[model samples]
Target: MKAPALEQRKLLDLQAADNRIAQLQHTLRTLPQEVRLAELQRDSVAARQEFGGVNGELEDARAEIARVEADIDTVAAREKRDRERLQASSSSKDIQGLEHELASLKVRRSNLEDIELAVMERVEEIEQRLAAITARRDDIATEERLLAAQRDEQRDRVAAQLEVAKSERSAIAGGIGAELLALYERQRERYGVGAALLQGGVSLGTNVALTESDLAQIRAAAPDEVVLDPDGACILVRTEESGL
Candidate 1:
């Protein structure tokens, strides 16, 4: 494939733009906030789960406290009735039985009260824990929002840069012949670099010296003539650096 020497050099511009676009895309993908955002997201999920568990425990503790208090109330009511009966009855046997039942009810009430106290304490502990966890989770949530915004901002900047690169590449590529441009694209796809300067008797693409026969061929070519590398690897764009 042949293109005017001056037109062929435009491939370098296209290559540079492509490289810049690739770098910008990489920047978008690996933004510092992206890593931190991921960690924050994970922490948010775990915090929610922890909060849910603690909330459930708190509810259960409250229910237990309520149930125990009700039991205590029932026992107290029974004891009150037994005490009244003891005051009104005259038979020794009846009074004795009522007194015994009142004593038993009193013990039962005391036990229920103790259980209620314990449940109430558990509820308090759970409430405190829930509060702490909630605050931490909220902090993490706030951080996540800020980081996400920063990440999006960085992405937008990189995206804009990429668009500019694309525009520049398109304009530069438009100046070259379609057939020549197609050849460069094909070589770029195959070897990652389509064209390079043949400077100081070396192929800049591979930083390797050109063979003697290749140098002879390039020297023999006319100005504005495009030449292929001896290895057929890339288009060699010659300039003052060609050492011809």
Candidate 2:
């Protein structure tokens, strides 16, 4: 393909813009906030699960305490009724029996109260744990929000730069002939670079110097000639440094 020397240089500008856009995309995908956000999400799930289990245990403890207190109240009432009947009775047997029954009830009430106390302590511990888990989850949520906002801001900046780069690429492409532009695009897809500077008798794309015959051939060609690498990897755009 034949492209004027100036038009060939435009390929470099287009390639630079393409490279910047690629970098921007890569930056968006691999932002540090993205990794941290993923970790926080996993932690948030685990924290919620722990909070749920602790909350269930706390409820059970409270229910058990209530049941124990009710039993204590019922036992106290029974003891009071038995004492009243014993005071009204004239028989010694009835009085002794009431005394023994009252002692047993006292023991049972003491055991139940002990259990209630234990359950109350357990409830307190569970509440503390729940609170701690809730706080941690909230902290994670806050950090996630902040980081997400920052990530979005960074992405917006990069997006703006990409739009400008795309505009520049479009303008540069418009200046080149259609056939040359098509070929450049194809070669760029294949080799990452569509054209290279011919400098110091070398194709910069391959970093290999041209032989005496090749140099003579390129020198004999027109100023607007498009030279291909010996390996045909890319087009060579001649410059003053071509050492012709």
Candidate 3:
């Protein structure tokens, strides 16, 4: 009976250890810093993508403006050449050809000017968008840095807690008797709850309660009998039984 009582206490200690270990494991698995860091990374990626797209649009607009300006310059040069041809030509047919060429050049210049104005407007819009994107990217980068620091701090705290739990478990295991410890370990392997307090005439830790007949059987055993409740059924521990 003394051995069984001792075994029961040892089982209680084991249960405490298991609960503490589970708590530490849960903290490690669901750290808030980890979730925050993942969100920060996702936001940073989106910001960078937006910034890149804006910059691409800006570059395209500038390229178009340059092309339009070059076309305008070509038309102006053609107009100057045609005007000189008109002043030097004496034949009516040659003058008419020069006039026609000048008319075509003027139309092309007007078209090129309109295109240039549209390209300038597009450039302004792209620059505004790029600036906004850059500012947002910078803000996200700052937030990410802060979140990374927080994550590191959280990891350190969890590590410290795990160490404390491990030391406490070792101390508890060392205080228990060897025979009692062995029995508790065996039961723990088979059942999650190794031992429970018989409280209110009932097992306090088991999912189900022991029946009246089972309690009567336990009471009928010898005064020194070592008994265990297995799956809500009572079992008398044989004196020679080293492990159960």
TM-score of each: 0.91, 0.89, 0.76
Quick one: best TM-score, which candidate? 1
Better model by lDDT, 2 or 3? 2
Model 1 lDDT tens row, 148-243: 888888888889988988898899989999988888888888887788888899998788998888899889988667777777777788888888
Residue 45, candidate 2: how far off, in angstroms? 1.1
Off by over 4 Å in 3: 1-7, 83-96, 218-227, 232-244
RMSD of each: 1.9, 2.2, 5.4
Question: What residue pairs are clashing in model 3?
Answer: 1-224
TM-score ranking, high to low: 1, 2, 3
Clash totals in order:
0, 0, 1
Q: After superposition, how far is residue 232 of candidate 2 from its true place, in Å?
A: 3.2
Predictions in order: lDDT: 0.86, 0.85, 0.73
Alpha-carbon runs more than 4 Å astray in model 1: 229-231
Q: Model 3, range 110-164, lDDT digits (tens) per residue?
A: 9999999998998998898888888888887888788778877887888798888
